[model samples]
Target chain A: MIHRLIYPCEQAAKLSSRAMEQALTMPERVRLRLHLMMCERCTNFSRQIEFLRRASRKIPEVLENDAD
Target chain B: MAKYLGARFARCHETGITTRSISTMAEDDDLAQSLETHRKYLQRYAQFHLRDPSLAEDAVQDTLVAALSQRDRFQGRSQLRTWLTGILKHKVIDLMRSRDRALPPDAFSLDQDNNSAEGAFDAGGNWVDPPADWGKPDAALEASQFWRVYQECCQRMSRRDALVYSMREVMGLSSEEICKKIEITTTNLHVILFRARQSLRTCISKNWFGTQHD
Candidate 1:
């Protein structure tokens, strides 16, 4: 029963990244949560992609200031 | 030349020029030159979102033309590049919309998720090389060097992937909006985004975060 609830790291990573753009379904959310609870690397992967999104928004300003 | 200056002066008075410097012509020349300086950077930026080189060039051209025509409105409150980018952003979006409408249904040729995992996973869908710890992410934001590295990683993506990624993340466009503009389904959009994020994560980890498993 517990095994069925667990998503592999690849699926967990995809769900975590997808969660940023759209709301995951209840089952997806639940399974991803369960997977994340046990998976340290996937949790870190989720956090890094979130960080990437936030960082990306500032790119225009960064490029502007880079001009001579 | 004197007749032209006289006409310009009369027009300036008629339009109620509030902040006219002594040499309006020279200032106009300077503004043109300055706008030209940022053209390459603007092209790079537009290409990152537009995917087609000609479309990107046309968008930048339209932006400069609009900027010059509305030179009076530039209050100099922001940097010149920032101001030009503000204009270019709109021009790029307008081009994207119009071009999407003009293209045939078969024009897009959106690739499937071909290189998504790129051997990151094994047959059982398990991680071949799992993600490593990235300490203190917020601190990296303060380092300009880190941003340069980030820019490099972004440039390393395929053109279509970069376009979709920039649309979603940088331009703050919604998934629905991107799907409509690019003529792609939400599922395909997710695949492109997933690939982009995965590649960027690996690049940043290898370059900036130092993949030392602690």
Candidate 2:
């Protein structure tokens, strides 16, 4: 059996939610940051947060201009 | 006596010159300049976070109006930006509440427990093992490109999915609260989140990575 070095992806996804909210405690934040540093998957997960935020911010202009 | 003198010298060395200048015209001028700077930043920040150009504009306007009307109440405890953001946060919440009535309850999931650890790995991380040559990609793409594609992709998602994605990923709402807001069961929430993530991944890969690879 392969020993997993990190938490499962679903847990990581859940963590991504907490990470975006800036809700993770300092120690948890540090651990997540460390995990992200070593893990491309987590790094991409973090980028997803940034991507979503950027996308959400753009909605106002689209909604305002009545543009598709 | 020499050691005592040496310790005294060290203590004196550690305590550098300390001068407390009385507040002056220059200090007041600097404060005024800082306040104006903060007001500008707060407006831009409000616009970014709220995502309704008009609501963002209104929130900032209200912030400025309130700040000006209550200028005398400005204490030095917090920076002006912090205070303005606090006010703007309340305004954003008010706006969301009003908008929430017309919108369906958010339906994103937060179910990490049911997956037999192995199944979760494929969706979460194990699917794409990084190459030894892999490094940070060039960040040279115009900021607008990423956001534009991202917005288009988000629009393609279901309303509930979009709302959950925005609330969880953008606004950072907790799963429990998002479930309550979106009016979905926990199981449904997980299903929504999973599907939303999958859709976003497909959209991003096709729009972003596929082009680069081609």
Candidate 3:
């Protein structure tokens, strides 16, 4: 299999979410960064994932003491 | 199958029941009151995960009844809300597991087709049109009505995609745990999650950010 520096937006998006599941290999890491460096869309997509994760963590916390 | 089959619920409201022991009625009252107070949160949490409002309402109702029935086991928990969420997670998963895999004929097709996020770049993997900066998006998240729209967006997505998003984002389940719990592999989890986020971001960008300041 041939490895490249940059991945397509689709692959980059998948890798971004995969990174949340487990650690990425060195090549996968490099390709993701290289792709993001050239693709503003994936960079924004990565940030959106980060934001969603953070926001979602607080959903259950919001009404924790409301009932008592 | 109605839980309210007890005469306690059927008793005339104008004149309270004078039949059985008062202690049983008191305990039932306390449990019912607690569950009722937390109903909205339970319903919202279920809706977020299940993506079907009617199914969500049923799950919430079931969860409330289950919690009340098992109140002896849950007596004096530090955070009742968290406990309720735990019950809700199981209900959502059980409902999903029991149903036929609702994968739409072509909506949830494999990532190889990659129809959603494709065509945004050239052959060399450069962005054809860059995404706009959504600076300090927390302001929108903190909005009073943001979650309503958020759930709306999740509901708009395909069932499987929304479930993955809900399990990961709303229920805070790890992707590995989700893969082990369900039939989906880790690779499919990635693609589904990517699609979910893409769809949510686009929806929010159009609906929330477009109409708000900053």
TM-scores across all candidates?
0.72, 0.45, 0.76
Q: For candidate 2, what is the lDDT?
A: 0.55
Please list, in the order the candidates appear, how each scores on TM-score for chain B only. 0.61, 0.48, 0.74
Q: What is candidate 1's lDDT per residue for A1-68, written digit by digit as tens?
A: 87798867888888887898899999999899899899999988999999999899987766656654
Question: DockQ score of candidate 3?
Answer: 0.45
Name the TM-score of candidate 1: 0.72
User: What are the per-model DockQ values?
Assistant: 0.66, 0.12, 0.45
lDDT of 1 by residue, B166-185 (tens): 88888777999889976789
Query: TM-score of chain A, model 1?
Result: 0.91
Q: Which portions of model 2 miss their true places by more than 4 Å?
A: A1-68, B1-51, B69-73, B104-144, B151-201
| Candidate 1 collision pairs | none
When candidate 2 is compared with the true two-chain complex, its DockQ is 0.12
Structural RMSD, model 1: 6.1
Q: Write the per-residue lDDT of candidate 2 for residues B86-167, one digit (tens) a residue.
A: 5665565556556666665433233445532224345444544321211343341334565567667777776556666766
The sequence of per-residue lDDT tens digits that candidate 3 reaches over residues B115-200 is 45445555655555555677888876566577667767777777777777878887888887898987788777877777777777
User: Deviation in angstroms for B1 in model 1?
Assistant: 20
Interface RMSD of 1: 1.9
Please report, in order, the local distance difference test score of every candidate based on alpha carbons: 0.80, 0.55, 0.72
